[model samples]
Target: MSAPGKSIFFMDLARNAGWCEGRVGERPIYGSERLAPEGSDSPAVFAGLLRFIGGRLQAFKPNLFIYEAPRDPRHMGGQTNLAAIRMLIGLPAVAEATAYACGVLDIREAEAASIRSFLLPPRPKGSGRRKEGELKSDVFKQIVSLGYEPKNTDESDAIAGWLYACSILDGRVGAAATPLFSQT
Candidate 1:
């Protein structure tokens, strides 16, 4: 980590066909469209993503890297959803590739729910759902709130995750705060 404000990178692995990775620093950067290759999570795909991730790390030189992990199907109210399928199917390769990257302890995992919780406004009175917004919409708003307009959904998710990790690292979201992820 660098000083009290570590530069951060957040990767939201493919929820469909490709993944999205974002870098945050003095100036936010998101060159995520090329991070994922065709054929999903094949070994060759992983190899390509590795080089891409490494190159981005070298270019941005972030002090910390955080990625979204696949959701636990058991926690999805026992219903199989497309999001879970894409995550379980497409992300091991991404995680493995990232873990094998630079020697520095720059990588970590931040659950999507955790990031949302940290960024979401309090639940509206008498309503379980967010007042009048979609999660992605709010996340995008937060990215804008942080002063960056994300280029894509993956980039948006990454930015949200980066903010969540920043809150934890910067002391806004502490140990008493809702945990960032469940036990594996």
Candidate 2:
């Protein structure tokens, strides 16, 4: 494959919008605050997330962008989550961001991947989530094949989309090899 020229920016915003504190390597890390507060949806909080992401991207100036596809709520396991519902409503914004970045940088969707694989990465071999090995391997191949891994889901997916777009631009992974779902 030709050397991937553009840089990919990957980012992910969890559906849960609260300051989650978790230990990573014995160090605590704090996540964003919950968008909704005390049984009510705060437009302020929601807009904050959008602004945070949009502002960050604008500052970083990535060549390509990708977003995780939202899930169908009815398909959710009987969970009536307001935040999840809210994310679905905002899906267009995500796509619009992609278009804007493309127009600004003259790049296209290079690739796409499930948020799970991008954010979680893959389970270590002979460890957890072995089934993910194949999918992870596939994404790795696509990432390395295309050429960059933008650390966050937002950036990674966007960058991957851009690389995928580049692949299309260069004609490597065709409509057949780059199917919506690869073989398990």
Candidate 3:
């Protein structure tokens, strides 16, 4: 378990990144920010994302930093968009670097599937795989169950990840919550 009185900052990184930050027992503050704008190149997007994360880190000064791990490209089925995949992979790298630069030594990552499992109800025994929209709706519902109204799927994802992180910090979860990266 993490130290008492620790604060955490969680993110669901993408072209439009979602973020949540607060102490474990308090109400978390969450929102999404657009990292890639029309006509912007990859470098510009990375720079903007860096600034966005860095600014928040400076503002909150959380003790721990956690973000959703990007899906493996090989598991993305027919998604062959190289640029999109690169951006997805780059976001966490940028977030990790920003956390280290900001002096937040404890950094970790959570899998999207793991977060969904921790927050969402189990599917029915005979139910098949859910479509993307259905999963987003379920995530939204889970966030609502936690008493927060997320503005979008991105925000909902970040909040769900935040809750999962809290569970890990409090020792309420076990192996399923192991960090993708841990410095403590």
Candidate 4:
């Protein structure tokens, strides 16, 4: 594993067909779009997004790809439900295609679920929700030298993955500040 370039390429996908704003701490980063065309769940749309990301990734030839995993497709239905099924179903295919197209690895969190845990806290017993935000605070503290809050959870998670990869590349994790958000 190698450190991904400083220029990271990130994309988020929701199961429904609408865009949503994301926040990394307090900063807002917007770029959520449905891969599929209107009223369609075509594979081409997912393939196209992967191609677009692949093109953007060419500049740095990023060693990593941080993508948002999709929600369960069955739950995505109706006007109120904005999740895009193509985003979920098409991600694995897109990741494989993108990695082949770019010649660099696309690290999907779902493939190795524990690989992403460097940035998340353990889920509490009997609680279905994972403490990702709590883990984010821990990571920020650990990477104080980086000196910036990610623009959203995706960004935060991506940064954590990057840091974890960096540690693997460099053979050590750099010292980080204890995040102010941490409970003393």
Candidate 5:
């Protein structure tokens, strides 16, 4: 159960998107939604994503909504395919538009790296750099240690983002003074 007021919703958007919903001092409920079939065309996939976001917005009625900001393909070190690049770029735009249409105006985005840095411990002085998979595993372990069972990496990532947002909203960490843009 969550404390009263200041509910938040966090999402990690993708074809198999993950979401977490909770209030300030509570355990969030999180799970993933497959937006469409594996190789569906972009329009169909996006339509499914739109409906999912809209429905969740209405059902949860959260005070603030946050999602992991998608990284650009260039920054992905050439490992991502064109199809994935398109989906990653388009998902947030669809989510934001859906939130606006649903009258949930206080939307924000946090970079995956930022969430990682906030939730995971710093690397030890002489341990050499850890790979991305290692970091993700550490994050999964951390969340599990906190007594949450995440079904997959996507859900864990959403939980991590939610944890980061909760830290900021609870005054444990400082967020940027201004949002990306104001609705008004």
Candidate 6:
């Protein structure tokens, strides 16, 4: 279990774009690039994601992992982040986290919906959601408020997810608290 205010690792996984955030006693360390293959492409794919996960795990060795895991699809032939999800599920570090995830309490998404709510941008009257540019700006602004300048949507989402997870860990976002890996 995490001691109060302990640092944690956060991941925001998407289609081909993903970001990992690490906050150690309040320091910003973010990543989007993957580990490169030494010679060939055989291990490149899994290495891309797995290596990132592993590197973070090895470096931080966090006590808890607050990950916005890939959303599983309900329908057949639907686009899902199965590849990334599968790799994450099988990682030794992740398995370790799962075994002792009680302290995690909750996980938050940095996807469009979460970003929209977390960073309520000034939308047009009768607007549905913030557009790409607006979201980027809004997300950037929110991260900046948190004392970090986000370079892209992926980075913003990762940082936003981290912030939400911190709130959950700190008992700030009440009631909506559910188990980790939930899309609700």
Number of the top lDDT candidate: 3
lDDT of 2 by residue, 6-85 (tens): 43333333343311111111111223333445555445545655665465456555555433444568877878688758
Clashing pairs in 3: none
Off by over 4 Å in 5: 1-3, 172-184
Residue 75 CA displacement from its true place in model 5, Å: 1.6
Local distance difference test, per candidate?
Answer: 0.60, 0.42, 0.83, 0.46, 0.82, 0.53
- Candidate 2: residue 65 lDDT (0-100): 46
Worst 10 contiguous positions by lDDT, candidate 2: 19-28
Per-model TM-score on C-alpha atoms? 0.68, 0.42, 0.87, 0.49, 0.87, 0.59
Residue 34 in candidate 4 has what lDDT? 46
Give the runs in model 2 whose Cα sits over 4 Å from its true position. Answer: 1-4, 15-42, 81-83, 91-184
| Residue lDDT tens for model 4, 1-184 | 9533233344444322211122212222323344556665556676666756566556546555555455555644653333344455666567557756786664544211433454344556987754647554555454333554554444444455444444343422312312223333
Clashes per candidate, residues 3 or more apart or on different chains: 0, 24, 0, 12, 0, 0
Q: List RMSD in Å for every model shown.
A: 6.9, 10.7, 6.0, 8.0, 7.0, 7.8
What's the lDDT for residue 11 in model 5? 96
> Candidate 5's residue-wise lDDT over 134-179, tens digit each?
9779878877766679998888888888878887787532232112
**TM-score of candidate 5 against the unseen true structure:** 0.87
Tens-place lDDT digits, model 1, residues 105-165: 6677777777787765666698767542488787776666555677766677776676566
Candidate 3 local Cα displacement, residue 132, angstroms: 2.1
Positional deviation of 166 in candidate 3, in angstroms? 0.2
Scanning candidate 6 in windows of ten residues, the lowest lDDT window is 174-183
Model 3, CA-based lDDT:
0.83
Deviation from truth (RMSD, Å), model 4 = 8.0
Locate the minimum summed-lDDT window of 10 residues in model 4.
15-24
lDDT of 4: 0.46
Give the candidates in order of lDDT, highest first.
Answer: 3, 5, 1, 6, 4, 2
